[model samples]
Target: MIATFGGGCFWCTEVIFQHTKGVKEVLPGYMGGQRENPTYEQVCSGATGHVEVIQIDFDESQVSFQDLLEVFFKTHDPTTLNRQGADVGTQYRSVVFYHDDKQKQEAEAFIQALEEAKVYDSPIVTAVEPAVTFWEAEDYHHDYFNQNPQNQFCQVVIAPKLQKFLKLYQQ
Candidate 1:
């Protein structure tokens, strides 16, 4: 099964899903954009209407979609619009590109449950959109955190975030 989520940087999201047990492969890509074959630079400019997302191919029998949703919600800020930490832009917006009606219903229900439970201080702004073209990111962007561990952004932003996710999800 495939699941697509955009919650802040693709690098950050990629790290979270890559560590997940049932996730077979996670591809960092851009979606919900107008342009075809959008480049990282173009998406960063926030002009292509694309959001940095991960196209996750997971084993549903091993990990349910709801479990993946739990990770998705807990890993990033869904309340803030088009922003996460120091990264701010439309390309960084929170979204779920559902592939089918079932995913759409589940996502909506999950958000409703969160709202009812008062998960965040503010209203959730995560967009639930139909899955669209997934333009894979440039070759260099793949496995970025592992490849660029010494990079300042990875050290300052991603490392700590990944640590928190590990602590929360690791058994």
Candidate 2:
């Protein structure tokens, strides 16, 4: 099964799902956009209508979609519109690009449940949209956090966030 999500920077989202069990692959890319073959710079400009998303291929037998959903919510702030941490723009907006009706329904219901429970202090602004064309990002973006661990952004932002996720989900 495949799930595509846009919660924040692709690198940040990529690292989290990469550590998840049963996640066969996590590919960073552009989705929810009208532009064809958008580059990272173009997406970063936030003018292409693209959101930085990771298309996760997972084995449902080993890990359920619900489990992924839980991890997704816990790792990123869905209440904030068009932003996660200091990364602000439409590309960082919270969204689930569902590949099928089941996925769409599940995504919507997940967000609904979170809203009903008042999971966040603010209203959930996650968009559960149909999955569109996924333009695979440049090769350099794949496994970015793992490859660039020495970089400050990876150390300061991604590393801490990844540790927090591991503690919550892996423990």
Candidate 3:
């Protein structure tokens, strides 16, 4: 199964899915954009209409889409618009790019359930849309937290988020 999500920086989203038990591949990419084959620099300019995303291929037998949605809501602040932590701009918007009708329905139901449950202190503003062109980010963006743990963003932001995920959903 395929699950694409955009929640703030692709670096952090990619890292989180990579550690999930059933995930087969977590690729950093750009989606929901107008530009064709947008480059990292171009998307960063905030003109391409693309949001940084992670395309995850996972084993459905091992993990459900609902489970992934749970993790997604927990890891990022969905209340904020076009931002996650220090990452800002429309490129950092929270979104789920569903690959099929079933996925789309599930995503919508999940969002509704979260709202009814009051999962967040504020309203959840995650966007659920049909899957579009997924342009993989430049190779340097992959596994960024693993490769650059010493970086200030990794140490102060990504690391704590990863730790929280592990504590909440240990394999």
Candidate 4:
């Protein structure tokens, strides 16, 4: 099944999902935007209404959507509006662009449950919206963490998230 999530940088989400057992592929892209074929720079400008998202293809039999949801909610600060870490702007806003009614319902219910449980100290601001056209980012963005392990951003920001994910879910 396909799941598209906009949770801060696609770089971070892309790396985490790539390490997931059942995730067949994680493609970095722009979603929840009105612009067609938006470039990374345009999305970064936060004027195109695009969010940096990763469109994931996962095998539900191996890793349930619930598992993915758990990881997504836990790894990032969903309470923060239009930001994740130092990355701030509309493009970094938390969102789940569901492809179908089931996905929409599931995402909504997940957020509801989290709210009820008081999972975060603050309210969950993650938006659950219908999936829109996914414009795949440039080829250089694909597998960015793998390719740019030595990058400062990858080392300082993404590495820690990867470690935490491996500890919590990959155990």
Candidate 5:
């Protein structure tokens, strides 16, 4: 199964999904943008209309799409618009690019359930859209958290988010 999500910074999002049991691979990339083969600097300008996304190839037999959505919602603040911590831009918008009808329906249902359960203090703003062209980010952007664990942004931002996810969804 394949899942693509743009919650905020791909570095943080990729790190969280990497620890999930059934995830086979997590590739950090750019999606939902107008530019083709956009560079990191170009996307950072926020004019490309691309959101930093992570494409996760997982084993559905072990981890369902619904399960992946659950982790996605929990790991990021869906209520925030175009921002996550210091990462602020349309590139940081909350979005899910579904690859199939079933994934689309499941994503919609999950958002509906979250709204009904009042999981967020504010309405969920996660955009459910069809999967678009995904341009893989440069090599340095991939596994950024793992590579730069001591970096201030990773320490203060990504680390806390990862910790929250692990504590909330310990298996």
Candidate 6:
């Protein structure tokens, strides 16, 4: 099964999903945008209206979509609108582009449960839209954290999140 999520940087989200046990592939991409085949530079300009997203292909039998959602919510601040930590823009918005009705329903239920349970201090602003065309990111963006572990942003921003996710999910 496939699940697409946008919860800040695609690089960060990609790294997290990559560490998941049943996730076969986590392709960093641009989605929920007006532009066709948007480039990273174009999306970064915040003009393309594309959110940095990851198209994850996972084994549902090994890891449920709900499990993926749990990891996603715990790792990122879904309560914030169009921002995550230092990254701020529409491209960094919290979103879930559901592939089908089941995903859409599940996402809605998940958010409802979180709200009812008061999971966050603020309400979750994560958008649950129908899946759109996924424009795969440029080659360099793939497996970014693994490829450039020493990069300053990776160390200061991504590494800590990755650590927390690993501890929480044991991935």
Model 6 TM-score, all chains together: 0.98
TM-score of each: 0.98, 0.98, 0.97, 0.97, 0.97, 0.98
Scored against the true structure, residue 23 in model 6 reaches a CA lDDT of: 94
Ranking by lDDT: 1, 2, 5, 6, 4, 3
Each candidate's number of clashing pairs is 0, 0, 0, 0, 0, 0
Cα deviation in Å at residue 123, candidate 6? 0.6
- Poorest 10 consecutive residues of model 4 by lDDT? 162-171
lDDT of 3 by residue, 1-171 (tens): 999999999888888888898999999999999999999999989999999999999999999998898888888888999999878899999998999998899989988998999877889889999999999999899899999989999998889889999898887
List residue ranges in candidate 4 displaced over 4 A.
none
Model 5, range 33-112, lDDT digits (tens) per residue? 89899999999999999999999999999899999999999888899999887789999999999999999999999999
The Cα error of candidate 5 at residue 71, in Å, is: 0.3
How far residue 52's Cα lies from its native spot in candidate 3, in Å, is 0.3
TM-score of 2: 0.98
> How high is the CA lDDT of each candidate model?
0.95, 0.94, 0.91, 0.92, 0.93, 0.93
Name every residue pair that clashes in candidate 4. Answer: none
Q: What lDDT score is found at residue 86 in candidate 2? A: 98
What's the CA RMSD of model 5 in angstroms? 0.9
| Candidate 6 lDDT over residue span 1-171, tens digit each | 999999999888999999999999999999988999999999999999999999999999899999999889988999999899889999999999999999999999999999999989999999999998999999999999999989999999899988988888764
Worst 10 residues of 2 by lDDT: 162-171
Q: If both were scored by lDDT, which would come out higher, candidate 3 or candidate 4?
A: 4
Listed per candidate, the RMSD to the true structure in angstroms reads 0.6, 0.8, 0.9, 0.8, 0.9, 0.8
How do the residues 1-171 of candidate 1 rate in per-residue lDDT, one tens digit apiece? 999999999999998899999999999999998999999999999999999999999999899999999999999999999999889999999999999999999999999999999989999999999999999999888989999999999999999999999999885
